[model samples]
Target: MKITVILCYAMFLGACLSFLGGCASGKSSASRVEVTPFSCVLAPDTNGSVCVDVVFRVPSQYLSRRSRLIIVPQLLLDGKLSEELTPLVVDAPIYAKKMYRRKVVQNYQDPYDAYTGKVEGVSGGLELPYRETLTIPLGVHTGCVQAIVTEDGCGGCTGLDTVEVASVRNLASLIQDTFELVRMEPTFHEGKVEVLLQFLINRHEIRSDLGNNRSQLKKLAGSLRPILADTLTRVGDFRIYGMASADGSRAFNTTLARKRAESLREWLLKELDIHPELYTRMVVDSRPEGWLPVYQAMVDDGHPDSLFVGQILRRYPGSDDDVQEQYIRRLSCWKDICSRYLQKDRKIECAYTYTSYESVLATDGMWIPFPIKQMEANNQAILCLRRGQFEKAVDLLKDFVHYTPATMNTLAVGHFRKGDVKSAEKLLRKVKLPEAFRNLGVLMALQGKWYEAYRFLKGSGSLNEAVVALILSYNEEAEAIMAELSDQSPLAEYVRALVTSRLGDDVAFEVHLKNACQLDELRLRAAGEPDFEKYREDKIFREIVK
Candidate 1:
């Protein structure tokens, strides 16, 4: 059979090849090439070339001896042809005699272009069932692009097929990181104390208002006045527990305990003379017998008889309360135990919660003052810090502007937040405070000095420290610090996902990342984090980070 071709290039249209059905040459004209639809994946190489991966196939009996099949591919970028991407030639040839029989053959051809462009192909000249991949190196361009592939027979003598390639990009996404600045602010310490007032057995009357006891009562009353005045202190809750010794009948002791609690409340209400208008609610309760003190006293006493007493208390076994009491009282050291351990039990316990006022720097780094002060003096730098204008804060604190350890430290924090780590480190070296260590740790972490960061982060309980610990794979330490945070932000959740991922807990990591992605900022942040690069291709991970 002889192959006849009609070649006509109209605008961008392809050409055609025609073969008469029968000829005496014994070659079948029915053999026609079928170019399967194909696609190209464009990935950028480090040396500034876009990799083009094109996959296509030709049927086994399609290649004829008269026709030389070649695939011509041109890159279309952004709806226009890329001038930098020259046309690539992909070909598969068959010998005429071999068309009648199927045989295994392998061939590789690195086709060279006039433009010196290179195309990578499999080790076979398009063999039968010409399924092959051609990886061509094209000039790099990030614009939306596709390949226009044309299968031509007999070089440009005839055009058999044309197809536009659809594509999926495998470009390496860029990472743009954003850093959060840590604020150096004053901190307040909150604490509570319990006051104990002892009473004679069975007597709820006032007595022993002398020595330290008088001072204690005075302090309680004075503390209440300040709290009520709402000046230096704010009271939270007041609880009075009147506890009685575990001696005598349960009924009598219960009544005695109530009386003692009530008596203490009355004395404070009447004698201290707090304003009647104060809406303070004091929770008053009575405990007729508390076994905690008895048990603790026995453990502390460490006597041979104390062991027997502990055994009796633990092994008494009966559900009857009176029987248990009688069984313990029958011990040989009952009187001594009663006098030593039970004496302190006949008392009114006042547990009051009050918040003392102290000026602490707020999130904006400004001191929340009880009274406003002029800013020209010591507050100018503070104002700059509050507004997160770190450059201004640095300028205001430089040299003669301010000269205290705290001022220097604040300036250091401002410098660190402003990306001036060297200056921050120099400033930190001149100071010796917990804040210095914390800031240094954060600075070190930012610099990727994991071990150094850990060294400074030790014994620190800041959120920044926790995040750094997580980044360094100190899971337990990070968890401990994270647990203490009253506010959990998206960044915190992202850090949690990182920690969970490091711990090999995929379920928890997914759970945490799902929560992190719920916040828009964190989801964007996750996309740029290299820590999750391993999971970037995972379905759930791609969904979350996307």
Candidate 2:
């Protein structure tokens, strides 16, 4: 009986050792947890989240029947824990049964019970695959994903292990945080001038001494002098209309008017020494003065018969000159009208149209050709600012007499570009110009105050505004603003590339990025840009950056 009992105890001890050995083998860390794609990307999602994809695998027979495996995925930024993801609990048969009885029979609740997945029959014989996409708020530059696994008995914890499943590196280089500059637009203007001269009743030749003709001619010459002298001015439309009195026959007056107009044109060509090409642009025409001037002169003189003459003139509306002159001849005031107002009708009228150009300072500090009448100090300063000559712009604007809102805004931009933030802010605060708002937005964006910048930049239709939208992750808004930009500059193309990149239009991103890299500065920038990091291996992207 004693030998039999001893043998039974040894057999029971062997069984206990076997069960413990099975649990011990499950605790071995070698190949217990397998994470595919050890190197991962923590990329920005269109929904404004930083996300990573991971697949967690457990080898067959990795779990013991009496134990459970608790897997907790975590995100670490710069070696510190940043975010904890949902825990995935894999329950072996015995532990799963205990958990079920605890919930159903004992009315017990475990906080992590909701995340548990049951493995039927023997737990160590089945493999477990947990695939997840972990997401966190944007702003983490570098990080890694790790899984914390705990193997526990039905009643208590047994073994704990932590493994780095994936890693994120070199992410800080992806950010594009530069602010864009806004340029001042050029101004345009058109002007018209007129000159009038009187002539003798039967003469077509110009008389310098007739009816203040010398002073009038001098004034006309003065107006044309600047336009003719200035290379920027373009003479557009010019007209010379010669007038004749109603007293003359229509045929004779027509001839006299033509001669008068021709005489004036020839005199101008001679006096101004206008080029032959310019002379060809002048238009000389003639028309009979009819009785309107006589009527007007009568009214001005307060003649008693003026009303009667006006009635006679109006009575022959649209009639031939002969019919109108015949009606006026019978009037009692006809003699006086011909002697006084008839002279007034014999005159030359001139109208001139001209266009002047204004010089524009391009972004590269080069002057774009047009014509500038004269560069005002403030305007010059504005050009300097656009050209990135910040100090010169500030100096030019320092003693300026006019403190208009536009000038103030321009001065602020200069100050801002020169790193004088306080002065820029102070100057901007004093003005209510739309340009000031845009500059203020740039300031806000530079300081990382994205929401404030967006408020000021909204609808400003500027590249700076578009960049702020991009920084704020408003991809659609940024793309819309970028698309509306009329500027086809390299900087504009660069911004378009960024917007399209975030919007997931790889085709457009490649096209724009290629165009933008025409400039060496943007090319260098794209090489290190985090936004384009995903495309770093692409043939076209590599070629562009290279």
Candidate 3:
């Protein structure tokens, strides 16, 4: 195949990959290739890491003639400057049209680019990104560019040109990691009380002047006013968490969460003398409704806590108004103590307002500010759920998000535990799952769209669920994944074992299972993970145990 490099005399249309030193290969037919989102990546960015992917298309005709596709990728930042490392290659390409990648690096620089200038070594299937180490800056820089390509074509070929490439944008914000724990520095002095509040629960600073407890509120405010003033003046950083419980309607919880957050904000500004200047960075920790689930999460996750969920649950059981109010107040106080030391981020915004549940729930109740009857249930349910009363909350509310392959397919075990496949399919329709639903390959598989899934998952440049779906699956599609597993072959074998088992192919299953056991040591960290349900039943699986 002749990839005619239609360059106007080596102008280099944004750094290109030239074929090998060949005499034009007998001037063959036009070889076509395509690339998407043109960036090459190194490793997995599942945690705090970063990733890059480049999409390029190559002729299917020359594919069988070679065993692999050789791709040389480069990194560029701030327009013209290249990364510390210039070019590298990945052996076998997985997708002819697109490539996916993950990266691991710590950077303070801005505007990153992943580019490929050449492609070589061809076989069947997609391609892989070159693996190498490179530094990425974390500053915000716009309009920067980089390229990755298959540069090993006929070097002496007059038609030497870039068939595909990728790019990257270095943004100036840190990823607010979801799994990150509450960052707190403890201080202890004789007779001084230090409180702890997890971001998951009691995220907002609420300001509700209960008519029944107005006197108590005022008195408490007065006593803390001086300390509040000092705390506000010394304020350097803040973390406002938006919280809601699973006890009410999704509509109600959403609104209630926002309002409670404001209530806390108001109290801080008024009695605490906190400056209004720090408003923008004060984000409410947005979470599911109800303090109980949050409290439970903290307890299970081993976060700092003043009281256990069981103790707090005993305080309020949905019927006692006084019990509910007391719990709310104690939680508020604890949050204040924690906030007194919370380091605020200058870039995040804090200016916001929320409508309280009491206010919104009161339709004609003059005592309530935002009046509407149904709104009360959401706020009340959250309280109940926090008190370890899920049954009561469910009676008053409906489940909002669904766990499933389409919803959070990245999380197979969680969804499996929440419900069976039948229920998952139904729930997935409504959940806003990222990437999970945006993939055609995975979707096609659900509808028995095998070939289509292959087209999308195998060739698409971006990291769609379809391409990596094999990592969690074992079907014909999964078999394709093994050939390209590279240094990550053990992972592929384990997945193959699972798929073969699902298909009732015992022979294939055992073979891959053994292969997976050998590699289990490499991934021993995932040993007890519930996600490995498929392997838990096999005897050989026990052999992999450390």
Clashes of each: 3, 3, 92
Best by lDDT: 2
**Per-prediction CA RMSD (Å):** 14.9, 15.3, 29.3
After superposition, the stretches of candidate 3 with alpha carbons farther than 4 Å from their true spots are 1-32, 36-49, 53-57, 61-70, 84-126, 129-133, 143-145, 148-155, 172-546
Least accurate stretch of 10 residues (summed lDDT) in model 2? 169-178
* lDDT values, one for every candidate: 0.55, 0.71, 0.40
Q: After superposition, how far is residue 129 of candidate 2 from its true place, in Å?
A: 29
lDDT by residue for model 2 (227-310), tens: 777776677778887776577688788788878889988988989888788899889888777778778888999999988877
The digit string of per-residue lDDT tens for model 1 on 1-546 reads 122232234322321223331111222334332233433334432233444444445444344443334444554443456443445443333322232233235342324323221223322224222222323233222333333333333433444454444332222221112222333322333333344665665677656563255656666676555555665565566777777666677777777777877776777787766555433576677765545467677778775567766676677644444555777788887887777776562556667666554554432345555322212322666667678887887776664422344556677777776877798888877756676676677666656565786788777666666665664557888777766766466666766786776667889889889987888766765664545657868999888877
Task: Give the per-residue Cα lDDT of candidate 2 at 516.
Answer: 95
Clashing pairs in 1: 107-123, 107-124, 364-386
lDDT of 3 by residue, 1-546 (tens): 234555553546423332222222222346544555443323222221234444445554443322223344455443455553344333224332233232224332312234333244554434444333344544322222244333333223222234324333221111111110111122221211111222233334332332223444455455445533543123334544444444335455566566655655565566566556755545554444344554555566565553644466666665433344355446644564234322221111132222222222111222333223334444555455446564564454343232222212322212323334444334334434343333334444444443454554563332222234433343465455544455335555655554566667778866776677675343352243223446666776566544
Query: Which stretch of 10 consecutive residues in model 3 shows the poorest summed lDDT?
Result: 174-183
TM-score of each predicted structure versus truth: 0.41, 0.42, 0.20
Error of 2 at 260 (Å): 4.2
